[model samples]
Target: MHPLRLLVVTLLIVTVNLLFPGAAHASPAVQYTNPIAAQRADPHIFRHTDGYFYFTATAPEYDRIVLRRATTIQGLATAPETVIWRRHASGEMGAHIWAPEIHFINGKWYVYFAAGRADDVWRIRMYVLESSSANPLTGAWTERGRITTPWDTFSLDATTFAVNGVRYLLWAQQEPGIATNSNLYIARMGANPWTITGATTRLTVPALAWETRGYKVAEGPSVLQRNGRLFLTYSASATDANYCLGLLTAAATANPLQAGSWTKSPNPVFATNATTSQYGPGHNSFTVSEDGQSDLLVYHDRSYRDISGDPLNDPNRRTRVQKVYYRADGTPDFGIPIPDGLTPARLISYDTPGAAVRHWDFRARLETNVTPLADSQFRLVAGLSGSGTVSLESTNYPGYYLRHRNHEAWVQQRDGTTLFNADASFIRRTGLTGSGTISLESANFPGYFLRHRAGQVWVEQNDGSATFRNNASFTLE
Candidate 1:
């Protein structure tokens, strides 16, 4: 009974049986929102105008150059990463670098990329990389070489646009008597950054039929400009479900600098619907969060399918996200293709409510509803299961329950800030009364409720209680 206390009680019973093995096992709620960014892949998000949101991806062991920065997008999966650039030994900065976007332009900070020769990943071309700082997390990038353009066969993704003040760039080449596998080109940019001035065009090819799936690949282009028009969405075939997403346009009045005047889109404005495990969702990039309302849709999927039987050697791809809609004639609609556990469309905070303040946001689904894998932390979704204390917005914090069966999910943040817990689970008790009343919904109208009757309020339910709307006001801090 004393061999170092029996080796510390046999290593605390083998660390509680390797962290609780058969205690009827109930320790699984720790998902900020579901696999936010693990294994990176072709992700590319950028909010930066100084407010932060930088994501970048495709480093899959190309030897470094990660980046994360978050103020929100759910704090970019626990942000705080930075690996700028790496792997350079001789000349064109050494070997196979791929993807790498990051733009800010005209005032500094550019990043367009694609590398080659580590025994050639097809001699991937294109480059750019600069930084004049405004806080690219403390600036100083400098590496503006090789942009040349015009042809030179096997090119890479590259993107950029400016219009009216001129500045083009769009890429994806192989024009010399093409054999397939590369098309999307464009030109413009020249004021240094390795020149280009003009003559490139070619625009779209893979020639519809879902752009020739799995290899006649058109290549990621991405450029938008609504109202007066100029879209250009690109990326097709070869990535998986034959990879997808296509659309092209031009007609702010004509001369879309010729490619025979834009206008493609015989189909494929985004695809993949193998019931919804989401195969090759294409390389996309478009933003609008930070409360500007919505419009996300980052891209990259494949939760399960062949995985290794090919989808280009599926690493389960990862990075899938949603939210992007608009159609009546304004074009750009992205519907029907959800199903990966569906629940990512509640980002509407307007800084208004008060009276005792209670806020709610949910989309976290599962039951085969899909949308659950987007993690950052604080997850406990089960209809809201957990301990007691069920209420908030009573004048500040009295009796604000959400105790979550004891694991934790208590919130109090300010105004005497004290109830801070995280791993929650309650699944029941959401009330306002009888058959229904546990409200705090928004899309602006219908069924909204925040009724606390003193110091913090937002009520809009009707059929009872003075038809409340108290003209906006909410604060519980």
Candidate 2:
């Protein structure tokens, strides 16, 4: 072979490797930190096909409907909100605008919200606005008039979803003959989302002790369909600390209009967590992560247990979001309302595939095929010493940091210990394969990188091999 030809071939190989390293590997799993927006309630986020997440929530004042959109979930926190519509100055929709949900249907945008009259704040009724613009934030939203019910009574929290080629509307309302303040109801939606075509059927009433706590309520209904079933979740009890989420399940093939077809969970599927200090967690909507890989639960909760005035007027029910998992039986597991802060994320091992970095009894180890929660999650925080490095703080252990002692990783309290300063900090670098994966190189030990060896974490120098690169690389999800 000619030397010139061999040299040309070598140069081409190097250039290709440099330009697209690790391109053969699958893309990393997407992860997001939560509390996407603060002080916003009845959160609704939907990922559109145009690769953006559109978010809308009840404003603290409950006086207007606002909309925001971002390419990423974390970006929604800083996205500028646009006031698309405001309450009427008088008559119906004059005050108390709540639980506004935006949906794109039939090449147009429709917003479903509940409003009440200025004179009678408790006379809440459902209303909608329509916009022909592609971008809901920039278009005109014309009122479509009030959605009148059979009986003049209280109703709110209207949500719409389609199954088996039919669209249905689910909401909570007060039946004239029913003693409870509100009960869950559903009906087939007409061509206009604001109106229902058929008779409304009572699905579930607030009859359980938990549901009847402060107020006999079953409002704020949201829908999630999976595993051949439709899961309808609603907020129950008062809007105070006792507020929680209740679930109603029905087979996807069954008639949703039939009240007996749905089975209500005997207990609240999601509720307040005293350990996390999150109270009154309810009124949740679901969306997929930016990469369209994971399901996310978007909801509102009070950071503190106590509120000074009426819970509805407290204005502290901030909007939060977290990843939602599923049970073995194909049921959605909301887990618990995570505490306010950076939500937990996992470190996926590149070499071992499904393995992840997990802590057992304060010692970091590689756990194979384990669920990424609690011990497996770590808050990737900025380095303590302003070095542009990163520190891994345990989600479950709180103040503990992942520190290397004698080249092995261990979770230890910060406490200003000498070892915690540089040992716990790492400089994040591109994976050896040059993929989106990350390699945490020890800030103190320079060439040494964090890697799992024999199911244990160790700081070791790179051996410049594919095996070594795979061992040292981790997907920061």
Worst 10 residues of 2 by lDDT: 20-29
What clash count goes with each model? 48, 0
Backbone clash tally for model 2?
0
Tens digit of lDDT per residue, candidate 2, span 100-120? 998888888889999999889
RMSD to native, candidate 1: 20.7
Please estimate how well model 1 matches the true structure, expressed as its whole-model Cα lDDT. Answer: 0.56
Q: Model 1, range 1-477, lDDT digits (tens) per residue?
A: 889999997886566446433211212111124346766666788787778788887766665567778877767877888888775775564776767788887677787778875555567788878888787756778787677776666888787877777777888877778778788888777776447786777877787677785578788787767768877787787776667788888876666558988988788877776644566677877765675545576767665545456454444566656665444366666653444432333211112111122233321111111122121112112322224322221111222323322221234332332222221212122332221212333222244443333322333343444224222211111
Best by lDDT: 2
Measured by TM-score, the strongest candidate is 2
lDDT values, one for every candidate: 0.56, 0.84
